[model samples]
Target: MPELPEGKVTQGIAIATAAAFFLLWIAGWLDVASLKGGFIPARVSGLVQVPGAVPVWLTPLSATLVHAGLLHIGFNLLMFVFVGRFVESVIGGGASLILYIVGAYAAALLHWSMDPTSTVPMVGASGAISATFGAYALFFGRDRTRGIGPLSGYAVRVLWLASAWIFVQALIGMAALGGVQVAIFAHIGGFVAGLALARPLLLWRYRKA
Candidate 1:
C-alpha cells in the first residue's frame, strides 16, 4: 500500500477542494446564462435519451466535482466537514482520497446503469460522501453515530447497522412508496467500495501489529 499522507495535508486538500467548488457554484449562479457549462447539460439537453454516451462535459469522472446549485453545494460540503474529518483521521489521507474518487465513480456507474439513457449528468460529492457514510458505519456504528439523532447510548455493530440502513434506503428508493430520487444507489456503491477497499488495509495493519 502507498504511504498515505498524514492529517493536515489531506485536510487542507479537502478544504481547498470544497472552496473551489463553492467559488464555481457562485460564479455559475451569478451568471445564470453561464449555467449551460456549469453542470446541468443533461437537464438542459433533451439528450437524456442517448444510449451510453455521457456528455463530454458531464463525464462520471468530473460529475462529483460539479454541483447543481448553491443549496446542493452547501448540503454536500456540510456533510463532508462532518464525516470527512473522522474518516480521514481513521483511514490515511491517501486512502480517504481514494475512497472519495472510487465512491464517486462507483455511484456514477450505478446511476448510469439504472439510467443508461439519462443524459441527465449527475453531479456533487454526495456519492463520495455516501461512500464515506457507509465506511463510517462499518468502522463505527449507527447509535454511537452522532448528528442523525441524540447520541444517547446507541451501539450497533457496523454490519447490522449498514444492513438496516440499506433496507431503509431500498424502501425509500422504491418511489412507489414516498421516497424521492435521492441517489441511494450511489451511496450504496460508495459504501461497497469503501468496505472492499478499507477492509484490506485494516486487516494488513492488524496483521502487522
Candidate 2:
C-alpha cells in the first residue's frame, strides 16, 4: 500500500464529485444534468443543437461532474481516490489539479475525435481519473524496459504503457460502437497525457527544492 498525500485536495475533489452525482441522483435530475452539462461532440462540431446545453468549451469539465448511474460514479470514484492519493502525494496538489483539468480536456478531445457527429452525451470522471492512473502507473509501477536506441529506459517504458493502453481502449471503443456510451478514447487520451506529462510536472515541482 502507498502512503497518503500531505494535501487534501484529492480527497476533497473525490468527495465533491461524488456529492455532485449523489445530489443529482437524490433529486432525480440525473438526466437533466446529463443533457445540460454532458459533453456532446456534435454540438461542438456544429452538427447538432440542444437547448440548455453548456457551451462547447465548458462541456469537458462539466461533463465530468455528472454521471449515468450509481455503479458508474462508484467505480470512477474508487479508481480516482485510490490512485489520486498517491499521485497527488508525489506531484503535489496544484500539479494534480492541473493534471486533472488537462486530462478532462484531453479526454474530451479524444472522445470527440472518435465520433465527431455523436450527439450522445458523455458524462463521468473516468477520463480525468485515467490521467491519474497513468501517472500512478508511471510513478509507482516497476519498470522493466531498458533504453532502446535513442530512447531512455523511462521513455521506452512510457511508450510501451501508452501503446498497451491504446490497444485496450481500441478494443473497448470498437466493442462499444452503436451500443454503449463509454468514452473509451477519452480514457486513452487522458492516460497518454498523464504518462507524457508526469515527468515534466515532477521536474517542475522539485526544480527549486
Candidate 3:
C-alpha cells in the first residue's frame, strides 16, 4: 500500500447524494427530475430538445443526483460511500470530489459519443461512483502484477480491471431490472478516469513532502 497520509473522513459527497435522493423522493418529483435532469445525448447535440430539460453541461452533474428506483440509488450510494470515503481518506477531500465530478462528465461524454442521437435520458450515479471504485481497485490490490508489452504493471492492472468491470457492467446493462438500461459506457468512462487519476492524485497528496 502507498504510505498513508493523516487521513480524515470526508463524506460530504455521499451525504449530499443521499440527501438529494431523500429530498427528491419527499417532493415526489423524482420522475419529473429524471425527465429534466437526466443526461440526454440528443438534447446536448441539439438533435432534440425538451422545454424543461436542464442545461446540457449541467445535466451530467444533475443526472447523478437522480435515479430510477430504490435499488438503483441504494446500490449506487453503497458503492460510492464505500469506495469514495477510502479514496478521499488517502487523497483528501477535494481530489476525491474532483474524481467524482470528472467521472460524471466523462460518463456523459462517453454515453453521448456512443449514441449521439439517442433521446433516452441516462440517469443515476453508478457511472460517477465507478470512478472511486476504479481508484480503490487500483491502489490496494495484489503485488503479483506484471506488465505486458510496453505497459507498466500498474497500467496492465488498470486495463485488466477495466476489462473485467466493463464486462460486468455490460451484463448489468443487459439484465437490468424492470428494464432500466444500465449505462455501461458511462461506467467505463468514469472508471478509466479513476484508474488514470488515482496515482496522480496520490502523488499530488504528498507532492511537497
Candidate 4:
C-alpha cells in the first residue's frame, strides 16, 4: 500500500476510465459540431442517438463514461483520485472496479426509470464517485479521517459526513435548484447501492474479529 509512483498512480483503472471517456468524446465531436459528445448528462439534452433509445442495460454503463466537457471530466477524475484509491485499496482493485460499474449502472437505471423520454445524454462519473463516498462511510465511519491542504480541517474531522452528503444530494434531487442540471436520482441510487453492498462486507469483518 505504499504510495504509487507519480507516473503510474492512476494508470490502471483510473486512466482506462478517463481514456475511454475521452476517446468516445472525440468520436462524438467528429459526428457533430457543438451538438455531439457522448458524455453523461446532468440534465436531459436530447440530441444524440443515446443508449436510452436502444436498450435498458446500456443506459447505466454508457452513462458512466460520458461527460459534458473537459471541466466535467476534471471534476470526476479529481474525486476518483482522492477517494477512489481508498475504496480500491479496501475492496481490492477488482471489487472496487465492480462497485464503480454497479454504481454507475444503478444510477443510470434509476435516472431512466424516472425520465425515460428526457433526451439528455447521461454522462460523467459523479454517481460512481458518490458511491465511493457511500462505501467509505460504511467502511471508515468509525474514525474520522482527517484532511490536509487547501480544504484543510474543513473536510477531515466529521464523523457522519457521509450522512450530510446524502442529505445534500437529497436536497439537490428534490429541488433541482442547482444551476447545472444533475441526475439526482442517480446519485441516490449509487449511494444506496454502495451502502447495501458494503453492509455485508463490514459485518463479515466484525464477525471475523
lDDT by candidate, in order shown? 0.59, 0.88, 0.84, 0.62
Pairs with steric clashes in candidate 1 = 48-119
Q: Give the residue spans of candidate 2 off by over 4 A.
A: 170-180
Q: What does candidate 2's lDDT look like per residue over 85-143, in tens digits?
A: 89988898999998899999999998899899988899999889889889999998885
Ranking by lDDT: 2, 3, 4, 1
Q: Candidate 1 residues 78-193, lDDT tens each?
A: 77766666667777666777777777777766665665555434566777777776666666553554333443233224445557767876776676322225666666777666
* Candidate with more favorable, higher lDDT: 1 or 3: 3
lDDT by residue for model 4 (1-209), tens: 45732323333656876887678667875223122333333334343353324243454665555666676678778777766676655655556666777788777767767766665565667777777767876666666455666553424443245467768887876775434577777787777677766655545445646
Off by over 4 Å in 3: 1-10
What TM-score would you give candidate 2 relative to the actual structure? 0.92
All candidates: TM-score? 0.65, 0.92, 0.92, 0.66
The residue-by-residue lDDT of candidate 3 on 1-209, one tens digit each, is 44543323336776777789889999999988888999999998899878877888899999998988788888887777766777887788888878888889988999899999998889999778888889988877665678899998877888899999999888888888668888889999999888988999999989999
Question: Weakest 10 consecutive residues, lDDT, candidate 4?
Answer: 30-39
RMSD of 3: 2.7
Q: Is candidate 2 or candidate 4 better by TM-score?
A: 2
